[model samples]
Target: MKDIFTCDLRTNSKLPLGGKTIVFGGDFRQILPVIPNGSRQEIVNASLCSSYIWSNCKVLTLTKNMRLSVLASNIQETTTFAKWILDIEGKVGSLNDRETTIDIPDDILIVDSTDPIGLLIEFVYPSIVENAKNPIYFQERAILAPKNEVVQEINERLLKLFPGAQQEYLSSDSLSQADFVHDNIDETLYSPDILNGLRPSGMPIHKLVLKVGVPVMLLRNIDQKSGLCNGTRLRVIALGKRVRKAEIISGSNIGNRTFIPRMSLTPSDKRIPFIFQRRQFPLAVCFAMTINKSQGQSLSKVGLFFRQPVFTHGQLYVALSRVKSKDGLKILIFDKDGKLTNKTSNVVFKEVFGNL
Candidate 1:
């Protein structure tokens, strides 16, 4: 970026950023750049704070909670909730001897439920069958989990409760021709069945089952100008062999209907040995989404399902801060014995905040 700016502006190459000012905005309290199998030190090293340009960067902090400020009726309650969220972000409260575990308040914790996941779904999406066709009902509500597998489980359970005829779409999977030829790998090594089973991050699943009114999220950014970017939620309107029509349920393009055709998508995960392609609809059932994917989104109602405790920095803070108010958030946590508990792990890499 600096080189391009220097050439375009006819400035000296030694000038910082070609004598042009650039602003970077983000919260270090949220998830950092994901390193597949990296250690604690490696993950921190990959952050922008560790970059050379960071030394020249001036840090600016925004202390206001604008989302809570919008609620004029509940100023005190929202202020309390906002402060609690920041306390969790900075690990400000009492901690366990290891300084990793924190106790959750009882008001928002769902306890003593025989079927926790079912109860959580009902709390977030009440009257699922009746409101399945209502786009507005799904627009401001979502369930968040720490892992993709937990999210898939919640989505499947919710889909079963949804009343409609299910349409199944199977993806066509194969190794990329370039990878196959360049690596000189035999085709039989990775059979179609094997390829179909691999569900890499940021790629849709092999078998996608959908109901007409159920909400789905885009896995790939198809058209940004039309507000069809990754993490955008939509409601399925029509199903076809080649394309699926959906109405945008969230973001700036709400109520805009668009056709999404089956496209080829490849996973960008480096842990995968070779490149493979899957031709399928670039969408996933989003009755629940992973916590990492829920960042930068604010919703009226959010369900935090803890199938397991958070294992990385800021996961707890990101999950808790998604909702607009404390009343809009509900959390369900479990111990190894399957009993509901109010204690959960909060992982924070304090070293990242050293320079700040």
Candidate 2:
């Protein structure tokens, strides 16, 4: 970016960002750059504060909780919730021996429930079957989990309750022809079943089941100008053989109806030995979403499902801050011993904020 700016603006290379004013915004307390199978030091080193630009950058902090201010009705309650969120973000709670676990307050914790997942779904989406057709109900609420597998479980459970005929869409997967020809790879090695089983991040899975009126999130940025970007949630209106018609439920373009077509997508993960392509609709069931993917999204009601402890920085905080108020948020922490506990792991990479 600096090289292109310096050449285009006719500025010296030594100048910071080509002597142009560039404002970078985001919280270092949130999740840092994701490095696959990376160590703690490696993940922190990949952050923006560790870059050369940090030496020339002036850090600016925005202390106001704008989301709370806009959505919260009670000023005092909003202020209290904002403070609590900051404490969670800074990891100020009583920690366990590993300094990773923190005790969740009783108000937000879902306790005395034998079926925690069922309770969580009920809390987030009350009367889901009746409200399944209402786009506003889905737009205002969601269940968040730390891992994709857990999210899928919650989504599938919620889908079973949703009232509609289920339609399953299978992706057409194959190894990239160019990669196969260039590398002289054996075609017999990767069968269709093997290709179908691979679930790459940010891409729809091989078998996608959907029902009319169920909410689905976009995996790719199909049309940004139309507000059909990645992470944008839409309600399926009409299912077709070649295309799907959905109504945008979230984002600035709410209620805007659009048609989504099946597009060929390739996995960007370099760890894969050969290039793989999958042709399918870039959508996933959004009854639940991973905490990492829930960033930048605000909801009136949010259910935090903890099948496993958070493994990354700011994940717990990110999930907690999504709701409008404490009353709107519900958390379920599952223990292996079949005992109810409010304690959960809160992973925070403090080194990323050292320079800032």
Candidate 3:
């Protein structure tokens, strides 16, 4: 910003930001900006509030969570759960020690489940096929998993439950056009199988199996105004060579049918030194979605499946708060060790919110 101001004064003899007013609003408790291969100081230095202009900024806060007031019934349970979520999120639990594990409320926990995914599907989507046509029905429920692999497993299992003929779509994976500029770039490095393996977690896989009436999520933001943004949920209506038709099942644009065309996708993984692109439909089965993807969505019924304990701050809180009412949530916490106890892990980096 200082450089930009200096450049403006040097060339145009005018300061664009000299008298301009700026306003910023956000919750510091939610996920912070993720900087890959960055140090703690580097990440903290990258935040907006860390700028020199922050001293001139005024902080105004909205205390109320509108989610609690919108619940239809079970106000008491919702209030209790909301506080519990806040307590865990703010590290105000009885065991508030930073290194100690937090105890989850017993009522919200599910145990003795050999088949957690199956139980979660049946619990969240009972009579899903019969009520598939109704967009509202799909909007009210979801399965939130901690990892992409778990989400994939749950989605594949749930896809089989949908009553329709399954259609498979394969992506055309090849070396990126940019790589052709390099004379020494090896073609074997861009093998389709290897490229598929290199795709990032949130991206659609090389092979996507879809059935009509099954719910799918947009992996990329195609049309935000039409409710076809990333994480937007839709039900498959028709499959085509170049475009697929689906009805928006969630958000303000519900019941609207939209055509999805095959688009070129590039994974934003820094681990892969070479750039690769895949041309395929930007949709993934949404029977289950990662907890990160479930952040902005509000479902009446939510199944929290934990194959592994949440390893970050506010993850447990985010998953539990997705539902409007406490009764709409059911959690299956795995006993990964032989402890056989329900425990919620909260990873709070006190330094992130320290200066705020």
Q: Which stretches of candidate 2 lie over 4 Å from their true place?
A: 1-14, 91-99
Residues 328-353, candidate 1, lDDT per residue (tens digit)? 88999988787889988888887777
- For candidate 1, give the lDDT of residue 34: 90
What lDDT does each candidate get? 0.87, 0.86, 0.76
Q: Higher TM-score: candidate 2 or 3?
A: 2
What digit string (tens of lDDT, one per residue) describes model 3 on residues 186-237? 8875677887665575577899898877889999998888878998999888
User: What is the clash count for each candidate, in the order shown?
Assistant: 0, 0, 0
Worst 10 residues of 3 by lDDT: 1-10
Worst 10 residues of 1 by lDDT: 90-99
Candidate order by lDDT, highest to lowest?
Answer: 1, 2, 3
- Model 2 clash tally, residue pairs: 0
Decreasing TM-score order of the candidates: 1, 2, 3
